[model samples]
Structures are given as structure tokens and as C-alpha cells.
Target: MISINNLTFEIGSRALYDEANWHIKPGDKVGLIGANGAGKSTLLRLIVGQYAPTSGTISMAKDLKIGYLNQDLLSYHSDKSILYVAMEAFERQNQLHAEIEDLLAKLETDYSDDILNKLSDRQLEFEALDGYNVEFKAHEILAGLGFSEEEQKRPLATFSGGWRMRVMLAKILLQTPDILLLDEPTNHMDLPSIKWLENYLQAFDGAIVIVSHDRYFLDRIIKKTVESRKGKLTLYAGNYSFYLEEKELRNELQANQFKNQQAKIKQEERLIERFRAKASKAKMAQSRIKALDRMERIEDVDDDNPTVNFSFKFSKPSGRHVVTLDHISKSYPNLEILKNTSAIIEKGDKIALIGANGKGKSTLLRIVAGADNQFEGKSEHGHNVSQTFFAQHQLEALHLENSILAELQAFAPKHTETELRSILGCFLFTGDDAFKKIKVLSGGEKSRVALAKALTADANFLALDEPTNHLDMQSVNILIQALQQFEGTFIVVSHDRYFLDHVANKIWYIEDKEIKEYPGTYQEYEEWASKRLVKTEVKPEKKVKEEPKVKKEKQAPSEDRTRLLSKKNKELSTLEKKIEEQEISVKDLEQKLADEAVYSDATKLQETTRAYNSAKAELTHYQEQWEQLAEEIMELEND
Candidate 1:
């Protein structure tokens, strides 16, 4: 329930919004859609009073609770657990709870009439604000956002950028505000988590104004679409799909009107040119010119045509088999992710790795790409295999000092400047954008540049993890098309449902520490999963157990699968012990280094320093190996 009347917001010389009149009615789940700099997020900021509009008014109902979530998670709270951070959304209620506690404590010693009155007032406020259900609601929101119960207890500072965003999102949702202003809320969420958010938002009370590039997310949640362009806010009375359809029709009509007006003006201009010398026709020509000049001209609608075209420059093909995993069992000291999982990737396979968050999809991809070799698995690459690996953190690996063009040229030294620019254009980096330093680029821009670099690299095997995470719908479509046409073997780990369905011929569903390959697109896999979910399960009930279900290892410990699992577990245990011993040695060496007696004796100091340095180096080595094992185990446990 917000209203904007004659709103004008300017940034330096540019007016982002010009005399815009808009009404955000009650229960309006609005998707704010526009180009990168078209002020979608700016609108949210203006509404939230982050910055004042140059003119006009954005008025809302009195005392409206507004929860605003933008890109503001950079400031880390070192001591706050994820749960505590989320629970802080109920700040007012929490304060009341604390005040009530203080009052109760005061009553234990001595109580006055004023103190008792204050306590009742505070308790009433807490009850009114649902203070008792605060923790439960916080946990529910956190869990929906993919944070595990254990992860909830972890400090907020320990998480990466994506996870930290989830924590922020959980905080916003837990606030239960009357209005939610979220900008790119699903940017860091996995597919399942995105789905969970969509479901949550569907039933969310209050008004919602979201700015996102996720088409599917908007389609599922938004009821009204608001598009901003050229300092105008245009409303469409439907979802994203309906917006697209209606926009096309409106543009076509506008184009026709503009064209017709142009044709009539051209005719009038030609008439004036032809009959100006003739006095007889001069009168008629002057009248026609006056009429033409008086007519209001219709401007052409803004074009959103995506001009993207590119192809992957794959080198010679690899052998018939691209890569193979033989009885692979990757584990950490705490958990096992892949338990004797085996899969053969062929030379022409376009596999989409699909699963919930923390599944071994990305790990398995890295293992195959030869980026991570610590896992206990027999992974073999076929003959003449040339691979380009794009991890989800691929943007972080970019050379920030170099310009986008320079970065590309560094990777492809032989390619001409013109050719590099052309490929960059296909990825939406055009003209002067090619010269932009990677350090100055936004997250989405960095992602696009990374994608451009990966696609342009001379490789026959591509291992991309979440490649479409920051891509817009148009860019994603282009990427899908390019990947489809590329004559190379690729394994892509992605959560974008449309991208997966379009580009993948084989689906690898990694669940329960095993890879189940299906010979169909992701859509087909979804259909199969849906049917399986509805199928009657045969396991005995926990309350009334009729019989025990069969365990399907197919053999005893004599089997190779069993032996492989045993070996993996043994390796994990050994690595853990080795790391622990090394850590102790490092700590002991540090203690020796700290001793004043060792420093006083020069020879003893030198000896102790050498021992300390050597132990620290050895400890670092053991810790790395231990980490890889622990990472796999942690993933499996979380999954």
C-alpha cells in the first residue's frame, strides 16, 4: 500500500524517473523488471528512503513495517551466528523480551507499581508482535532458505558471499514486515531453495516489490509486472510471461503507428519539394506542409532485441570416452559423498548435473576437470582431452587488473582484436565495455566476462558449474544455444531449470551419494521424479514396523563396492589422524619459537626456527589434504 505521485529521481545529469505516477496497491506482488541500469533497484531504494527522490512524493500507510534487502551483506558481524542474525529481524520483539526479563529480575528483588506497569506493557507488546514464536519462525525461514540446523549455529562470518546473502534473506523473511522490497533475492539460491522461496512468497502477506533477473522466479511469484525504461514506469497487469507477450504486442502497435506517421510525413515533404515552384500547386503544398507540421509525431518504442551470436571454438575431438570414474568413493573424515559411484562420460555427452544444495555435483565436476585431485577415486581422462573448467567461483578467479579485452587476449593470444570484440559483443560486452577493467565490473558483468572467456578458450571438454547464475534470460538463451551448437563434450552443473532443459541431453541426478544417469532432458527427469514421489513407498512405518526393508548393496564386504567404501573410510581416518598430529606439532613448534631461552642461545634459536618453519610447512600440507576429505564428508552429511 504505497503511492507515488509525480515522482522524479535524478542522478547527476540523468533522470532515472521523470514525473512518474504509480500506485502500489495492497497485496501487490510486483516484479520490477528492466535493463541493468534502468533503476529497478533504485526504485526500491527510493521507496525505502535510502535516497530521496529529486521531486514528488512516495507516500505509504502510517507505521507500515518495511523489510528491505539489497546488496548490503558486505559488513560482517563476527560474533553473530546465522540463527542470531535471522532472529535479529524481530528486533522490537527481542528488545521487549529483554526488557520483560529485566523487569521480572527486578521483581525478584523489589517491585514498585510503576515497574509492574512497565512489565505488563512490555509483555503485551511482545505478545502482540508474536514474540513467543520468534525463534520458531526464524528457524523455519532459515531452513526454507537451505540453512541446516548445524549451519544455523555457525557464525555468519564463516559463510561465503552466496551463503551470506541467504542469511540476509532469512533475516528479511523472519521480520514479517508489511512490505518486502527484495533485489535479486534468488541470486545465490540453489534450484530447490529457489522453489522453496517461490512457495513462501506465494502466500506472503503484505505488498512485495522484487527486482530480479530470474524469469521463472518472477513467473511463479509476481502478479503485476512493472518495467522501467527511459525514465518511465510502465505497468503490465500480469506475470513475466504475460508482460513479455503484452510488451511485444504494444511494441508492434507503436512501431506500426510510428511507421505510418513517418510515411505520411515523407509524402508531405515530397509534395512540398515537387510543387513549390508551381504557383497553382503552391497554395495546396503550403497547406499540406502546415497540416503535416501541426500533426504530433509518434516516437518509436524502445527496442529490447537481443543481438547475440557466438560459437565455442572447440579444438579436435577427444577419444570416444571423455572421462570415466571407476568405483569412486570420495569421503571426508566426517562424511562420505560418493559411495562407490561410477559413471562414464562419453565424448559427445551433454550432461546436466542436477541435485539439491551440497550434493557432490560440483565436486565430481572438479574431480573430472583435474582441478581437485584429492578425492579417492580412479578418474581417467581419455586421449588428447583438452578441458576448460569454469567453477561457480569462476568470477573470483578473474584477473581484476586487466581490461575485459586484455583478459580475453591473454587467454587467446592468437585471436585478432576484432574477433575478440565480436565474441565479447555476443556476451553483451560491446564497444567501450571491452576496455572496462575487471575490477570495476559488477558481479553480473564479471560472470558474463568469465563465461565469454570460457567459451572462447580452445578446449574440447567444458566443465561449467552454475554458469547461468548471474545471467539474464536473453544471455542465458544465447549461452544455451551456443552450448547446444558446440561440438564438444561438456558437463554443466546448473540450477536454472530452463537452461538445463534446453542444453542437456543426459541428466545426472546426484542424490544419496550416488550418480543416477537418465537418458533424457532435465524436463524428463523432473517428470520421472514427480511420478516416483507419488509412487507408494514400501518401507515400514517408524511407529509400526511390519518388517525391515532390504538393503541393496547386492553383495557382502567381499564385493568391490564394499571394499572401495572400506578403503575410502580408511583413507579419511588416516588423513584426519595425520592432520591432527601435524596440528599438534605446529602448535608445539610455535611454543618453542615463543620461548625466551631459545632466542637467547643463537644456535638453539636457529635450530628451533628451522624446526618450526618445517613443521608449519608440513602442517599446511596435511591440513589441505584433510580439508578436501572433510569437504566431501561435509557435503554428504548436509545432503
Candidate 2:
């Protein structure tokens, strides 16, 4: 759909891409990946016409629609509801609605055949585009993106920059252009919302050229990987995993070749040095010199920025059942985010609390950690559940007037400057960087400082909300590993799929105003939730008849397509209804399991847990069956 020919983008005395050529064809889900300063986002901007390349050209198919989700939110006019902003994407549909409304008013005044004909055309166009269902589709998109119905009604200006980015994302999605240019699109999203986006893109027929640092998201969605580095573009035929393996092999091959060349040169240099001193071997010495001169030197491959390595260790351990919420509920005058939700967090639980934005995930964390007391929740802290809360907004709590070194000192006053600076180095803050004032640090830098402070604190229970927001990929990995190894219990509210899958043994899915706990990784949760009831009803399209110009006779299907499609469709519908009923049954059983009376009876508790788990497994089994049936239906229809 788009082409980049001999592209060369430079920034005064520095070149990001030079003579780089790449083509983006239809149905290609390409992951544009590189380090932080590798110009990935800049390249997206160049493609979107925000900034022109220094040289070369980016061309797209004529009149093709291209939707772009900028890494940074663009400025807008006065306050508008999120729903209104998202609906703005369907420009034609909205315009048609307005026109139809105006026409209806005009008809009340007076009407003619000319006006009637115009109204008919407009109505046909509206119906053709499914304009009547725009509101329902918009609402679904908003809800999938993690905005509650009430939150959707709020003015756009009321949201933070991150949430506002979601609104922009919703806008681009509703557009459904031929090509989608998303730059770090998952930056502000939570885990559940990211999953929704993954499913959204999975069904999207258009090509996607995305620049993202999110590893798991890329691994799941991207079919081709493009690495931009050192003024060059490297293309991989497969996903990020394939790219990693191929890059490693290429590096090793180059290293071996480089070593062999160096060895040959050393041998030649020694021979020449010995022969040069002896006139008897003058010819040999000359030959060695020529060989050395003709030898092609191997290029040294070094990373532009060194990877940051760090680990966090807890100073103490929290008691078993570190925090527990009994009959907790939260409401913001108009919206009740949570309702009588109860959970018991144990020590070393390593829970990943995932949900859409503004769904009480943060509120629950605050309530449990005793950070917010206004909520209606009976939170019981176990013996010495000393809490350490880390949030994106809490970075402001750091004294901007103080230097990073000074901040760490405040966390651990006993640690000397040398010790504190060493720890700072692990977080990518070195010598002079350690001395930099907290006031001058970027959001990412401040996040690192806040994390450094939190890690050093003498707390056992950690309540982290979007902790990896500002950290780079390497830092995220390191933090995940550290959390995995940490002795204390922690509840991390993050959208990082890889981090969540690797770190959290338990997932608390907060959705539909309820907290449902699942004892598994995010991937496992996906395996369980993949059971969306399939709709099997298929309507035949209006097929055009052929003209009589040596036309061949059409053969009717002899029990090949229609019957098989109908059978699979019927089976899928039945299984879907059954699964829906099974889900409800499991929910009731789960509620029973949560009852104090059930737990009081040990036999009943065991039976209920086993039954609930089995019922849940059965639901997934039915979903698997539906998946197979759907596949069969698609195959028959395609054939």
C-alpha cells in the first residue's frame, strides 16, 4: 500500500536512516522495532507527513485512506465527550445523520419529489454503510478500550494525557483505513485493553505498520519484523522471536569472521616484521604487506546505548494474607466502578491486577494499601503489611528540588554517596547522571528515580500501578525478573503482556464492575476467555448473473458447501448458547465458593472449588469446539 524508496532522513550532523528502502504491501502486519533513540516514532511521523524526510520519497496508493495514531496526543479544541470524539471518525455516517435530521425538519415544513429523491439517496447511502448501528459500534469500541459508560460521557479534557491517547486510538480505529500507522500505540493501555486491541487487529483486514516496544503484543500480532538501526533497515521474514535468533546468528557469524581476519592479519604482521629485517626475504615481506593492505576490515558492531541491568530486593516479608478486602465497593457519584468485591491477597502472591482504565483497579490497590480511605471497603492488613505504593502520578512526590542522589539518600539515609550512586548506575543513571537534579529529569527519568526510591524502601507489600510506563524494554525485563525473585508480595497494575505473563501467577480480572480472580498467567486467562460465543448465521450476498457470451454452464454444489455450512453454523449456535449458560452457572458456583458458609464446611468448600474449576474448564472446552466449528464453517464458505 505504501513504499519508501531510497529514503534518507537526517538531523543536522546525524543520520537516522540513509538510503533505506522498504515496501509495505497489503496484509502485512509489520513491527517497526528499534532502541529508544533509533527514530522509530520519527519514521512514523515522516510517513504520516508530519515531517518530510531529508531526501527520498514516501508514496502511497492514490486516494487510499491512511489512519495514523500518533505517539503523542494532538491538541484539540474545546471539551468534548469521549464518545463524541470517537464517533467523529465515521465522518460520512455522522454527516448523513445530520442531513437526514435536517431533511426530516424540512419535510415538516414542506416536501417535493426532488427533496424526496435526495432523501432516498441519502437514506440508502446511510443504510449501505450501516450508519444506524454507529452508536452501538462506538460504544463497544469505547468499552473494549477500557472506558466505562460513565467515563465515556465525561469531557475529553477531564482525562489525563494517557487516557486522551486512548480517545485518539478509538478515533483511528473507527476510521478503519486501508493502512494503520500506530507508533507505540499501547503506551497508555492496560492488559485487558491491550488484549481487546489484539483481537481488534486480528480481525482487521487492513495492513498495520506499527512501532512499538511492547514485546508480547508484537509477538502475537506482527508477522514481519523490521529493525531500524545505524542508518539501515534490516528485514526479517518472521516475528520478533525470529528476528532475535537471526540477529544473534548474524552477530556471531560476523564476530567469527572478524576474529579470523584479525588472526590472519596478526600472523601476516609478524611475518612481515621478521622478513622486513632480513633482505633475504624481501619478496615475502612485500607479499605480506600487500595482503594486509588488500584485506577488508570487519565493521565493529556496538550497541548505541548500553542496556540497563538492575534487580529489586525486599528487605522483609509480609505475613500470609498480606491484605484482604471484605465487601468492598467504590462509586464516584455517578459511576460505581466496583460492587461488593472481595479478595484476599496472600504473601508472595505476585498478583497481576489487570483491567481497563478507571475501573477501580487503582482504587482497589489504594484501598488495600491504605493510601485512600474514602472508599467503602473493609481492608484488613495482616501483621506488619507495611505497604510501598508506586504509581505514575506518585513520581510527583519525589522532591524535584532534590538531586537523584539526594532522593536515594532520603530512601536510605545510611547508604553513603558511593553506595547510592552505584545503585543509580544499575538504573541507567551514571556518575553525572546521578548528580542531575530530579527537577530536570524527563518523565522516564523520574520514573526510574521513583522506582529506585521504592525498591530501597523497607516495605513488604508493593502496590504498583503502571510501573513500567516510562521504563525502556530492558528496564522492564529487569524489573519483571526482580519482581519474580522478590520475597515480598506485590500487586502490579500493568499492560505489559510479557511482563504480566512472566511475573504474575494469579490474575484479578476487573471487568463489568466485578473482580474475578483466576489462578493462572495472562496467557492462560486468554486461553480461558477465548470462548466468545460464535454467531453462525450467514446471509448470501447478491450474486450477479453472467451475460451470454460463450458462457459455461454452472454446476450446482452436490452436498459440498451449503449443507456443511448450515450444519457447522447450527452446531456453533447450540454450543454458544450452552457455553453462555455454563458461564452463568460457573459464576453462581463461584459466588457460592466465596460464601463464608461454604468455607466453614471444609467438604463443601473442596467440592465447590473443584466443581467451579471443572465447570470453567468445560466452558473452555465448549469454546474450543466452537472454534473448530467456526473454522469448518469458514473453510466451507471460502471453498
Candidate 3:
């Protein structure tokens, strides 16, 4: 659908792309992956003609429609109703419908030949575009995007920025453009809505190019990954997982090639040096020197190695119970954020708090961390439970006036300036970068500094809210590993599936005004969710019928025994399948949920959550049945 040829773009001295060649074909689901500052978004803009390339051309077929969604730029007014804005995507249809209506009205009268010809032509055009079903299609798209029937009728102005983005997404999805460009699309979506989007995109009949940090989202949706690095693009076939494996293999090969080339160049240089020292071999030495000069230098492939070593050394173990909440309820005016919630954090426990946006996951974290205390329930930190709270806004809470070095040094242990600078360097703040004011730092840089500060506190109980925000995959992985090895208790609120799966042993899911605990990894939680969905879908209705006591007694044993055995077998099979499916679903959801685009679609997320919950419930029921069946089988065998 679109072709980028010999593209070169630069901002001052930093070249974002150099002679980059990339193409987006019809029905292509391409994921743009790269390290922070690698210009994945920039490349997207170049493709959309939002910015002109310094050199080369971006060519597109005539009349090719494109829909681009940027993270920071959304044109929406709160005053307009959500449905009205969404309906605008089919404005052409709406206009045609109106014209057809007007033409029909004219048909009722004795119209001139010119008017008749115009009316007939308009009718043909309207029929060809399926203008009759435009309203129905718009409604379908809006509902799919998670906009409630009532909310869709409400003015867009009443919705928050996140909801506004959903409205924007609904518009684009309804438009069904030839090419879709999305950046960080999933930042605001919940799990249920994300699943809906996955299904939608699976059936999307166009090319899609998205930039996201969510590995699960990419793995599930993308067929190819275009990685930007060091002013070049590398294409990897298959999903994000495939890309990771293939990229590692390619990097290894590149490293080996670089080593071999260096070795050969070094040997040649040695021989040339030796030969040059001999007068008789001076001519040969000169020829060798020329050859060395003419040889193209082997370039090193860039790898996203973790810059910071975030190893935490806890000074002492805390009490058995890290933190406890009892009968906790919180509200903002009439809005009840959380209600009668109770939870416990035991020593060495890693818990993930998950919920929709504004569902009070963060509020719950705050109450546990003692940031907010005006609640109905009691929150108590166990003896010696020294806690460190990393809020989502920690990046913004830093001392902006202080230099990066000064900021870290203020909280850092008393050490030499050089040592302090070295610590800063580990987080990618090196040389004069340490002198840069904290206020001047980018969102990612500020996050790193905040993390550095949190690490220095030496807290035994860590409560982090969205710590993975503004961090690239490399940084997120580093943090994940650090948390995995840390002995401290961790309670985190994050949407980053990879990080959650890697570190969390339990999940506290906030849904339908309740917080439910799942005692397992993300994979197990997914199984439980899937089973729940199955139960809901295939629930058997109860029937009331009178029967004679003698007849009931006679039929009960056989029926009950057969039903029990059949149910047991079915449950066991379902459990086994769920275990396998959950493993895959968790891995898939974790990857895609991390993508920025998937998060943006509230409707899709709502659907995904529904599907996920169904799967989870079904799996949980099956697991319980399987355990019971195992016991029954053992008893029967023993008898």
C-alpha cells in the first residue's frame, strides 16, 4: 500500500534514518520495534507524509486511504457527543443518505429531466457505497470499542482524555482505511477491550503498522516486526517472540563476523608493519597499507543491553506479614473507587494488582503504602516493614532544578562525587549528562532517576504503581529480573504483561466492584478466567419437575453416578486443555497488552476481559473438578 525508498531523515546531527527502505503491503500486520530514541514513531510519520524525509521518496497508490493515530496528538472536543464524532467517519455515507432522501422527495413531484437524471445518479452512487447500512455500521463500531449505549450518546467533552482516544480509535476502525498507523495504541485499554481489538484486527482487511512496547499484543497480532536501530531498519518475520529469538541469532552472527574481521585486520596490520620496517619489502608494505585503508569497516549491530544494574541488597528480613488491609473502602465524593476490600501481603510475596483505568488499583496501592489514609478500612504495616512506594507520577515529583548527579547524590549514601557519577552512568546518564537538570530530562530519563532514588532507599517492602511506564522493553526486563531476585515483598500495579508474568506469584484482579485473588502465575490466572467464561456461556438452566419419592430414589444413584463420572472426565479434559491454553494465552496477552496501540482501545479491552474472564472461570472450575476426581479415583482404586 505504501513504499518508502532511500529515506533519510535527520534532526540536526542525529540521523534517525539513513537510506532506510521499508514497504507496507495490503493486509500486512507490521510491528515497529526499537529501543527508546530509535525513531520508530518518526518512521511512522514519514510514511504518513506528516514529515518530509531529508532525502528519498514515500510513494503511495492514488486514492489510498490512511488512518494514523499518534500518542500525543488527538483532535477531539469534549463538547461533541461521542457517537456524533464516531459517526463522522462515515460522513460520506451520511451525506449520500441525505442526498438520497432529498432525491426521493423530489421523485414524489413532477421533476424535470435534469433533476431526474441527477436523482438517479445519486441513487446509484448511494447503493454502491452501502449507504443504507452506515448508521448500523457506526453503531456496531462504537459498541465494539466499549462505548456504552448511554455513553455514546453523551457529549465527548464529558469523557476524559483516555476515553477521547477511544472515540478516536472507533472513528478509525469504522473508517476502515487502506493503511493504519498506530503509536502506543494500547496505553489506556483494559484486558477485555484488548481482546476485542485483537479479533477485530485479525479480520481487518488492510495493512497495519503499529509501534508498541507490549510484546504479547505484537505476538498475537503482528506477522512481521520492523526493528529500527542505529539509523537502519531490520525486518523479522513472525511475531514478537519469533523476532526476539531471530534477532538474538542474528546478533550472535554479527558479533562473530565482527570478531573475525577484526582479527584478520589486526593480523594484516601486523604483517604490514613488519614489512614496512624492511626496506626491501617497503613496496609490499605500501600495497598492504592501501588494501587495509580501502577495506570497509565491519559495523557492530546494536543490542539493547540493560544499562542499569538494579540489584537490591536487603539489610534484614521483615516480619512474616508485610502489610494487611481490612474492610477498606475509599471514595471520591459520590464515586466509590474501592469498597470493603481486604488483602494481605506476606513476606517474599510478589503481587500484581490489575484493573481498568480509574478502577482504583492505584488507590488500593496508595492505601497499602500509606499514601492515602482516609478510608473505611484499616491498613497496617507489619513489624519492621520498611516500605518504598514508587508512584506513577514519581517522575514528575523529582526535584527538577537539581542536576541528575545532584538528585541521586542527595538521597544516595555518602560517597565520592566520582562514585555518584558512576551510579548515574549505569542508568544512561553519563559524562555531561549527569550535569543536566532533572527537569530537562525526558520522561524515560526521569523514570530511571526515580528508580535510582527508590533503590537507594533500601526498603524491604516495595509498592510500585506503573513502574514500567516510559520504560523500553530492555529496561522493563532489567527491572523484572531485579525484582525476581530481590528478597523484599513486592506489590505492583502495572499493565506490562511481561513484567507481571516474570515477577508476580499472585494476582489481585479488581473487577465488578470486587477484588479477587488468584493464587498462581499470570498463566494460571488466565486459565481460571477462561473457565469462568465457558461456564457463563454454557450454563445449564434448572428445571422443576415433581417425581414420586420411590422413583427418585431408584433413579438417583445411577443418574448421579453417571453424571459425576462424566462430569469428572469432562472436567479433567477441560482442565488439561485449559492448562495448555492458559500457558499460551497468558504469554500472548502479556505480549500484546504491552503494545501501546492495544491499550488505546477501551472497547476492545472490554471484550478481551470478557473473553479472558470466561476462559479463567472455566479453567478454575475444571481444575477444582480435576483435583476432586483424582482423589475419588484414588479412593476407588484403594477400595
Candidate 4:
């Protein structure tokens, strides 16, 4: 539905895209992938018309609706409830409904045929747009995005940035635009909500273009992958995993070709050098030199970034129990974030906290770390625990004016100038980079600095919240390696599935106002979660049967007709109840099949699908029995 012809976009002397041609057809779910600074978000803005290409034509069908969700958006503040904001997407439907109502009011008096015809047209348009279910649809969208009914009634200003983003997502989903351009849509989402979004997009009819770092989300939802590299776009069929394998193979081939070309060039140069010393072979040598000059040299691909390597060396070991929380409960006025929460962090334990955006995963982390104490709980740390807590808002707490080196020096007072500089260097702050003021650092740079500071402390236990937020893939791997090697206890709250899958030894799922521990990796947690959800949805089918006494009386009635009728009535009531239970079972199985997480698990998914089918078959059997019983009951009543 949208086409870009010979697109060229540049920022000052840098060219983001040069003569790039691309097209997005209807129902295309494309994942935009690129390295840091590859202009993925910039291209998204270009497609949405937020930024005009320096040169090229972007053509789309006239009047085609498009929705763009940018990373940076103004906080929506109004007295209107969240539901009202979501319902705003169907403004046309609302307007048509209002017009219909006005027309009906006018119909009470003498109205012209022309007015009546217009009213009829408006009514038809409203009905065609599903105007009657606008509110219901809006509510569904909100709930799918993880908003509770009470939250729906809350004002927009009462929510935090992450919650506000969910509201925006709800608006976009409810709008159902012809094309959706989303940038890091899962940035503020938890595992469960991310699952919801995946299902929503999988069933979405319109084309979708997303820029995200969440591999699991993309792998499950997107069918096509578009990668930006070296001022060009490469399209790959299939999901993120497919793209990864293809890209690796392609890069290896390119590297081999480059090496071969370099070897040939060197060989040619060596032959020319030897022949140049001989007067008789001077012409041949000159000819060879000209060939070397004219030959197009293959450019070598840039090497991957160096990994940030570090090891924690503690002076003394902490007690067996690093930290413990007892009956922790926190609430903010009307919102109860955490209640009766208890967890124990032992030395050498790596734990991952998982939940939806507003489920207070971070809050729980903070409470455990003793950073926030406005709660009714006893949080105790082991002797000489030496704890370090990394909050999501750590960057805001930094002294921006201090140089990176100075910041580290202030945190590690015992370290010499050289020691501090060496520590900063490990985090990519080299030479003058260490001297740069923190205020001028990029988001990624600031994140690195914060992480460096957190690690510099001789803390045996680290509590990090979204530490991988601004880091690139390379940096994330480096941090993962560092954390994996550390002997200290680690409790991190993050949404990056890959990171969690690689580093976490245990998964803590926070849901339904409680925390449940899963003693396995993220993949295992996913499997367990899928099975649990299916079991939760599978209901027992109810059975219906005719009363034995009524059945016997049908063959030999006459004087006992009233007794048979009473028995028949009782049997009918029992059959109705049984049918109702069977119906509930069928609905439960259907819900299980429709759940997103069930589809995410490859192994359990097949089992769940089979189970769902079996349940459906069982339901059908009960349905047939119910029908037969109904017929028999009807005959008895007529008699």
C-alpha cells in the first residue's frame, strides 16, 4: 500500500540511505533491524512523513490512514479517563452516531424527505463502522494492553510514562490503521503484555513495520525482516532467527572474498616488485602495475566492537544469605503495587524478575535493595553484603557536569587516577572520552558509565533494573559475560529476553499480585508458563443423561402419567445443568487455543493444540448428547 522510489535521506554530511527503493504491501509484517547508529528509527520517521527525505518520492494511496508510534512522544495530559482517550480513535464513528441521534430528534417534528434520507445514510455509515461496539472494542484493546478495569477509569495524568505508552498503544490498536509504524513497541512492556501484543499483531490485517530489539517478540510475530547496513536496505524472508543465520553466512562469504582479493593483490604487487628490478622485464612489470592500479579492490568489512571485559574481586565473602525480604507490602495511595511479597537472595544466585509494565517488578527490586522503605516489610542484608543497586533512573541521578573519569573517581575514592582511568577504559571511555563531561554523553554512554560505577564498588550483591536498556547487542553480550563470571548474587529486572535467557539461572514471574519462582532458564519458564496457561483454561466437560425412572415410564404409562411428568421435569433440570458445564468446558478450551503464550512455546504448543482439539471434540460429543436429551425432554413435556 506504500511505495518508496529512489529514496535518499541525509543528515548534514552523513547519508542515512542512498537511492534506496522499497515497498510495503498490505498485510506485511516487517521487522526493521540494524546496528546502532544505522538509522533504523530515521527510516521509520521518513516512511511516516515525520522527516522528509533529502531526495525521492514516497507514494501512498490517497486518504489511506497511517499510525506512527515514535519512541519520544509528548506525555498526554488531560482530565479525560484512559478509556476516553482510547475511544478517541473512533471519532468518525462517534460523530456519525451523534448525527444519527440529532436526526432522530428532528424526526419528532415535520422533517423534509431530504433530511430523512441523510439521516438514513448516516445511520447506515455508523452501523457499517461498528459504531455500536466502539466502547466495547476500546475496552478490549485497553485490557489486552494490560490495563485493568479500574485503570481504565483513571485519568491519563495519573499514569507513569510506561503506562502512558500502553495507553498510546491501545489507541493505535483500536484505530486499526491501514499501516502501523512502531519503534520499540515492547520497550515499556513486560513478558505477558508483550505476548498480548504479539498475538494482536499476528492477527492484525494491516501492514506493520516495527523497529525493536526484542528478538523473541519479532521471531513470533513478524514474517519478513528488513535490515539497514552501509546505507542500503536488505530484505530477508522469514523471521528474526532466519535473518540471523542468513546474515552470518553472508558476512562470512563476504569476509572470505575480501581475504582472497587481498591475497591476490599482494601476490601481484610482489611479482611487480621483483620484475621491476630486471631491465628486460620492465614493460611487463609496468603493465602489471597498471593492472594493479585499475583493479577494483574489495573493501574489508569493519570488525566487530571489542567486548567489555571485567571481573569482580571481592575482599571478603558475604554471609550465605545475601538479602531477605519478609512480608513486604507497598502501596501508592489507591494503587496497591506489591503485597505480602517475600523473597530471599542467596550468595552466588542469578535471578531475573519478569512481569508486565505496571506490575511493580522494579518496585519489588527497589524494596528488596532497601532503596525505598515506604513499605511494611523487613528487608535485611547479610553481614558485609556490600550491596549496589542500579535504578532505571540512575542516569538522572548522575552529576552531569563531572567528567566520566571524575565520576568514577568520586565513586571509587580509594582507587588511584590510573586505576579509575583503566576502569573507565573497559567501558569504552578511552583517553579524551574519559574526560568528556557526563552531560554531553549519549544515552548509551551514560548507561555504560552508570554500569561502570555500579561495578566499581566492591559489592557482593548487585540489583540492576533495566541495565541493558540503552546498550547495543555487543555491549549487552559484554555485560552478560561480566555478570556470568561474577561470583556475587545478582537480582536484575529486565525485559530483554535474550539477555535473560543467557544469564539468568532462575526466573521470578510477578503476576496476580504475587511473585512465583521458576527454577529454570527463561526458555524453560516460557514452556512452563504456556502449559500452566493451558491448564488454567481447560475446564471439565459436564455430562447430561435422562432420568432412569422417566425412561421406564415412557414404555408403560397410563395411570402413572403425573409421576412420569415429575420425573421428566427433574431429569430436564439436571440435563440443563450438565449442558451448561459442558459449554463452559468448550469455552475454556477455546480460550486456551487463543492465548498468545501457548503459541510461543514450540514444544508445548503442539501438545496444547492437540489437547484443545480433544477438548473441542469432547465438547461436541456433549453438545450432541444435550441435543438428544432436549428432544426427549420436549417429547415428555408434550405428552
Residues 1-639 of candidate 4: C-alpha lDDT, one tens digit per residue: 989888899999999899888789999999998877889999888877889989998899998888888757535677789999888889899799788888898888958997899998998899899999999999988888888999899999888887888888888888889989998898767777888899999999999998887778889889999988888888999899999788788888889999999999999989998999999999999999999899888778665555545556677789999888888788887789878978788888899998777778888888878888899878899888988899768899889999998898889887788777776766767788888999998888899899988988888889999998877666776678778877888899998898999899888766656666765578867865676567557622211243445666456456566677677667757766776877787787678767888878887678877877776777677666654554444345434
- Candidate closer to the true structure by lDDT (higher is better), 1 or 3: 1
Candidate achieving the largest lDDT: 1
The weakest ten consecutive residues by lDDT in model 4 span 539-548
* C-alpha RMSD of each candidate structure in angstroms: 21.2, 15.9, 11.9, 15.2
Model 1 Cα lDDT, one tens digit per residue, 1-639: 899999999999999999988899888999998888888888888998988999999998789889888877646566689999888888898899889999999999877898899998999889998899999999998898888999999999999888898988888888778989988888767888998999999999888998887777899899999988888899999999999999999999999999999998898898899998899999988898889878998998865755555556765779999999988888777868798888899988999988877877778888888887887769999998888998757788899999999999999886889889988988888899999999999877898898888888888999998898777766787787779888989999987887888999888877778887766678767765665565425322432553332343223434565565566667788977887898898888888878898888999999999988998888788766754554444333322
- Alpha carbon deviation, residue 500, candidate 1 (Å): 1.9
Q: Which pairs clash in model 1?
A: 332-629
Candidate 3 residue 465 C-alpha distance from true site, Å: 1.9
Report every candidate's CA lDDT.
0.84, 0.82, 0.79, 0.82
> Which scores better on TM-score, 1 or 3?
1
Worst 10 residues of 2 by lDDT: 533-542
Cα-based TM-score, every candidate: 0.81, 0.74, 0.81, 0.79
Top of the candidates by TM-score: 1
Which lDDT tens digits does candidate 2 get at residues 1-639?
Answer: 888988999898999999898899998999998876778888888888888988999998788888888845657643989999999999999999999988888888678987788889999999999998988989999999889899899999998777888889998989889989998788988767888899999789999988876888888889999988888778999888888888888888888888888888898898898889898899989988987898789975564344434445555567788988888888898879888878899988889888766678888788877888876768899987777899887887899889899889988886678767766876778779888999999887899888878777777888998888867776676577567756788888888878888989888867667677765577766665554212212222212333442233245544756687777778888998999999999999989998999999999999999999999999999978876675556445433
As a whole number from 0 to 100, the lDDT of residue 373 in candidate 4 is: 85
